[model samples]
Each structure stands twice: as structure tokens, then as C-alpha cells.
Target: MRLSNKRKAPLYNFINTALIMFLVMGILAFFAEEMRFQLLGMEAYLFIAVPAMLIIIFYLNGRQIFEYDSDGEALHFRNRNIVPFMSTPLSDEFPKYKFVKFETFTFLFFKRLYITINSKSGNTILKYEISYLTWKELNDLKFSLNKVIKNNKEKVNDE
Candidate 1:
């Protein structure tokens, strides 16, 4: 089973908007100051660095995809961009993984989730931050994770 979850969060939107505004402001500041490298020594560096960093951040935030692949016995986390990558398996031994949900109180209520994988080596915890997931996606992820966990638990018991 392959479950595709799209996580959209206002926090990312906010950050993207803020970054864009900063880029614009930085550009204007660069030009308005007449490229005075001596007077604006540190600020001059912002022009080149901010755009480069923003491009990377945009690619990472915009093109992310997470997949739960049961048949392959793996959870794949990917970022669809120039750099394509997959998550490393927990370990050679089949590790036990479970999903946990918790709520955060901000201006509004937000629900968060994380995956805990237990292996012979150690335990690995992957937290799904509010910036990466919305409440709806979190619920869907929880449901899918619960199903996977139940099946694994049953298989363990049967063996």
C-alpha cells in the first residue's frame, strides 16, 4: 500500500512570504544605498546570500513528499527537486515503529505527530513539525500509521 500525504501549513506560507519580503527589501536597500560597499559592508553581503539561501529553502519546503510504502516495507521521504533522496531504513533488523500525536497551544490549537522507530541499535524519533503538516494531513497520517502499526504488532504476536 502506498499512501501519499500532502502537508500544507500556514507557517510555511508565512515563512515564504517573509523571505520574499526580505528579498525585496534587501534588493531595494542594496540599490537605494547606491551600492556603497564601504558604508554598507555587512548589508551588501545580504543581497547575494539571501537569494541563494531562499532558493534552497524554497526547493526544500515546496517540493517535499512523504510516502508510506507497506509492500516495500519502508517509509519513503522525498524532496522532488534537483537533489532526490530517500530515507534510510531504521536498521538491518526489522525495527518497530509507531506514530504518536500531540497537540500544541498557540494562537490556535495545532496537532503534531512523530514517528518513533525502535531498533537494536537505538531509537529514532522523527517529529512532524507544524511547518510541515496541517491538521487534516496529520489525521490522515495518524490513521495510516495506526494501520501499519496494528499489522506489524499482529505479525509479531503471530510469530
Candidate 2:
């Protein structure tokens, strides 16, 4: 099975970048203001510059790539239009374990979606807030993953 999405970068990358940029800029602005007050009589807001740059970089160059190929036994992910962020092996054991439950919750004032996957091995959770993804894409991913769990359970039962 081959599943792919040609969407923009993942929302997580944007959020992470924004947050880090905010902090860095905040500090820089504080120092800039302090220096100006001490050395010169002019007041300046240098902190805003860093965050502005971050926003531009994120919007212009940010890209996300999601691909899952069951036949090839790989799941590939790329973020920020840079090197691949994740390349996980598609374990054959996935199909044998039953899906205990799966849930999605809204966070950050409902600006993001947090998906929690629970199986026999435990729980794996991922959060996304990008507007580019559709419900169908999310559902299809879940369905494909469930196949692995089902197969694992069947094998156990047969044994």
C-alpha cells in the first residue's frame, strides 16, 4: 500500500519554530532596549525583528512531506523543507496487536489536534495543527495502521 500527501510543512514545525524564535527575540529585544537606554537616548524594539524573520522563513520555505509505503516497510517524514526528520520502519508486528483505543483531543484553545494511538505495546501520540490536512487523510492512515494490528492478533490466536 502506498499513501502520500503533498501538503505544506507540518504544523508542528511551524509552532516549534515560532516558539523558539519568540523566546530568542524576546531576549534580544530586551538587551537591545537596555543597551540603547544606557548608551544612547533612542528607544528601539529589536526583539520584533527576530520573530518577524522567523515568520517569513516559516511561511516561505516551510514544507512537509508525509509518505507511507507498506510494501517497502517504511514511513518517511520531512519538515521545514530540510532533511528528512523521521524514517521509521514499518514493523510487521503492527498487524498482530489489537488496537485498544484511539482518541483525538483539541488543545491550545482548539487550535491543534492531538491524536493518541493505543495498542498492545502501549500508546503513541502525535499532534498536528496544520490546516492543509483533511479528515480523509487522517482516517486513511489509521485504517492502514490497523491492518498491522489485526494481523498480529490473528497470528496469536492461531497459535
Candidate 3:
């Protein structure tokens, strides 16, 4: 099975632009108010708080394109940010039997997948951003990963 979220990456540009536009509008509106001191309620709060909160939340999301391929004899994983400069890309390929385990976790809006793989030196864990995947895609990924783990167990038994 193969899973990819590359198609959805283009939407980030629109989202980023919209967020910036909202922040700019908020700042402009706040300054445009003639009586800055008179503002002392939700109206004043919304102008600054909302935009700042948006930026902070967006930064925490770390929206990265994720690709996973389990074809032939190896499993492939690729993770890269659509923003380019945010982080270095992670590309890995290893044998099916070497896949030790896989886990997932979410913090606030941040979601990630951690894959543990076996090696001669030690077991290494890989992290992938899964914040942008749809429900179907996430399920497919879980299924694929479980299948690999099952296969790995079988191979161990045979050995």
C-alpha cells in the first residue's frame, strides 16, 4: 500500500495568505479606531489576540507533506515541508522485516507518526508530520503500518 498527502500541500499557500490578510486587517482596524483608549472589551481583544493566536497556532502545526510507500521489498518514507526553508527533508527506505514498530501522537493541533526500525547498531525512530492527512488517508496509513508490523512478526517466527 502507498499513501501520500502531496496534493493537499498547495492549499497551504492559500491558507497562509488568508492568515496574513486577517492579521493585517486586524492590526489596521485596531489602529484605525479613533479612541484607542476607549476600547476596553472583546472588540479590543479580538483585534490583537485573535491574530496573534492564529500565528502561534499556525507555527505549531508544522504542516509538512508526508509520503509512505510499502512496495516491493522495502518501505519508503518521505517528509518535507512545502515551505522549503522550515526544515530539512527526511527520506528513508528499509527492508520490511526491519520495521520494528510504529506509534502516533498528537499535542494540541500537532500530530506526528513515530516509526521504529531495527538495525545492527540499535533501533532508530523516525518522526513524520501527519497534521494534514484526511481521515481516510490516516486510516490507510495505519492499516499499512499494521500490516508491516504483522509481517515483521511472522518473519521473526519463521526465523
Candidate 4:
């Protein structure tokens, strides 16, 4: 099964980013004035430069587009611009058990699924922001991931 990117709540990312940026800007405004008043000139610039750089980076690369090909056991994520240099693929062996976890709030407005792959080398986690997925797609992803993980584990055990 192939799961293409779903676009829902397009402004969700923008809202989150704006909220965090606003908080940082507010802090800088409050603190910078206080520091200048107190004769701490250099410290004021540090506070502005550091977080401003971080916010710029976050706005540029924080949101990604995810593409999943379950039949091929490949998952790919890339920056919004779809640049090949920014693409990341998470494809390989599956974890032993409980490789997927579903998280939802009580109100159920937000949902996320995390798929964790563990190997001899390290662990990688792929997150599915289900708020952007259809109900059928979300269920299929959970089922397909579990099925693949179970099959991989059994094959390893047999050997």
C-alpha cells in the first residue's frame, strides 16, 4: 500500500510556528529593555541573536512532507521544498515488537502514530501526524506496520 501525503489543516504548522515565534519575540522584547536599562548591553544582543537565528532555521526546515510506501517497506520524508538533498529515507529491518505506538488526546482532535525501528546499530522513529490523514489511511498504516514488524520478527526467529 502506498500512502501519499495528505493535506489537512494547512495552517496548523503556521499557527504553531507563529505561536512559538511570538513567545520568543515577547521574551526578547521584555528582557532586552530590562537589560538595556540595567546597563547590560552585550547580554541584550546575545538574547536577540541566538533565538532569532533558531526561529529562522525552524521556519525554514521544521515542517516536512512524508511519503510512505508500505509494500516496498520504505518511508521517505523531505523538507517542504522537496529538495532531494533534504530527503531522508527510513527503510530497513523492523523492530522485534510493539514497533508502532498511537497517541491521541481525550478530545480526539489531534492524533499521531509513531513507528520505531530498532536495529543493532541504532533506533529510528517515524512520526505520522494523523490529523492530516483520513480515517482509512490511518488504520491501514497502523495495520500494515504491525503486520510487517511481526513478519520480520518471525523470520528472524526462524533463522
Candidate 5:
């Protein structure tokens, strides 16, 4: 089935980093007015390095998806302006499907949703950092996945 949601604002993972960099640069710039070459050099480096790093990180991971599809065989996750990430052989013999929310206080990054598929082989399949999704999208994805699992279960029961 096809599932989608309205796109929301991009979630920035480098906010704290940007803020700290700005603060440090401001301080260094203030001190550099006294002709401290070392501090001036540090400020220059910080001014360039901080935004450059932020841009690189944003480009690498900031693309967020508003829709996904699972057609009983594979999972297709799509995002804006980037290649979609897909998973195949969507397992059905899982003991349970768990939804989890994880946050990293150190980096000020939060993930609003994660799906963990527990398998009989004592292994788990995990999909992480789905915070960009709206509630509707999340629900649709859950529903589609459960439907697949249910069908698989029924097929096994018939056999």
C-alpha cells in the first residue's frame, strides 16, 4: 500500500553546534580587537569551520521523508531531493513490532519514531530516526507493515 504525509520543516541536527560556534566566535572576535593574533586566528578558523561543517552535515543527512510504501516484499522509504532508502525481504515471522523514541541529549538530536522487528532467531531489525514524519505518515506506515505481517501469519497458519 502507498502511504504519505505532508512535509514539515526540516529538523536541524546542528543547532547546538551552530550556536556554540557562534558564541565562541563572538568571544574571540571581541578579544581579537586587542590585537591578540592567536585569538584572531582561532576566531577566523571557527568562523569558517563551523558553518562549513554544518552545511556538510546538513547535506549528508538532512533530507526528510514524508512517505513510504511496503508491498509485502520490500519497504520503500522516500525523501525530498535525495535517493530513497529501501529494505527488502520484509520479515514476517517476528515476535513483535516495537515502536520506540530515542533522544540524544549530548547532541540535542531527537528521533520521534523507530521500529524494531523482533525475530525468532534472536535478532532484531531496526529503522531509526523517523522524526521528520508526521503522525499520519507514521500511522500509515505502521498499518501497512502490520497488514503485511498479518498476511504472512495467515499464510503460515493455512500451511
Candidate 6:
């Protein structure tokens, strides 16, 4: 099976554009004397605080593109942020027999996928940010990984 989120790029781009516009407006309000003191009788701190908080929230709820492929005796997983040039992509491909286990964890607003593989030295864990994947996609991913793990275990017992 192959799964990817290339279709969601436009949605993420829209969110990024809105956030940037908001930040620009916030900075403008900070400099405008009348808007800062007169409009809605709001505090100047609000303009600064709100935009900063929005940025933090956006960062925590990372917008990323995720791909998972399990075919031809191997599994491939790739994760990259939507923001270009900000961070490097995470990718891993290992044989089905090497797949040890898979787990997931949620921190704050984002979800993570952890894949563990047995190596000569020790167990190595790879992490990927999966916050942007929908529930259906997540279920598909979990099901695929679990199937591989089960097959690996059975193969070991047979041998």
C-alpha cells in the first residue's frame, strides 16, 4: 500500500498565508498611535501577544507532508515540513524483516510516529511528525505497520 498527503499542500499554504498577514497587521497596529489607543479600547500588548501566540500555536501544530509505502518486501516512510528551507526531511527505508515495532505519542497539539528497528549495535528509533495526517490516514498507516510487524514475528518463528 502507498499513502501520501500531497493533496493537502494548498490548505497548508492558505493557513501560512493567513498567519503571515495577521502578523503583519499586528505589527502595523503596534506602530499606529490611534489604532493602538483608540480602537476597541484594547491594550497594545494584545496586538503583540496575540500574534506571538498564534505563531507559537502554528509551530506546535506543524503542517507537514507524510508518505508511507509498504511494498516489495520493504517499507518506506518520509516526512517533511511544509515550510521550505526551514528543516530537513526525515526518511527511512528498511527491510520488512528488520521492522521491530511501531508506536505513537502525542505532545501538546502534535502527534508523532516512532518506528523501531533492530540493528547490530542496538534498537534504533526514528521519529516523524504526523500531526497533519487525518484520522483515516493514521488508521491506515497503523494497520500497515502492524501487519508488517506481525509478518516479521511469524517469519522468525518459522525459521
Stretches of candidate 5 off by over 4 Å are 4-63, 78-109, 112-122
Would you estimate the TM-scores of all the predictions? 0.45, 0.39, 0.85, 0.44, 0.41, 0.90
For model 5, how does the per-residue alpha-carbon lDDT over 1-159 read when each residue is reduced to its tens digit? 776543333333245356557667755665674456554544565655665665565544434444565654555545442323422222222232221112212123433344445446654544444555555666676676667667656776899
For candidate 4, write residues 1-159 as lDDT tens digits.
666553532454575467577668857775867856667655666656766666555444323344556554444432232233543533333424534333332124445556565646676665544445557866776676667667777876999
Best by TM-score: 6
Least accurate stretch of 10 residues (summed lDDT) in model 1? 86-95
TM-score, prediction 6? 0.90
Tens-place lDDT per residue, model 2, 95-122, is 2233333444433322233334455567
Error of 2 at 50 (Å): 12
- TM value for model 3: 0.85
Best lDDT among the predictions, by candidate number: 6
lDDT of 1 by residue, 1-159 (tens): 444443433444566567778888877777766555457766776886777688565644433334444445555433232123423322122333432222333233333334566645666665433324456655675666677778777877899
**Which should have the higher TM-score, number 5 or number 6?**
6
For TM-score, candidate 3 versus 4, the one ahead is: 3
Candidates 2 and 3 compared by TM-score, better number: 3
Clashing pairs in 4: none
Displacement of residue 155 (Cα, Å) in model 5 is: 1.0
lDDT of each: 0.51, 0.49, 0.83, 0.53, 0.49, 0.84
Candidate 3, 1-159: lDDT as tens digits: 888888877687777778888999987777766356555455765887798898778767765688999989999999887777877888999988889898989776688999999888899998888887877898899999998889878877999
Total clashes for model 6:
0
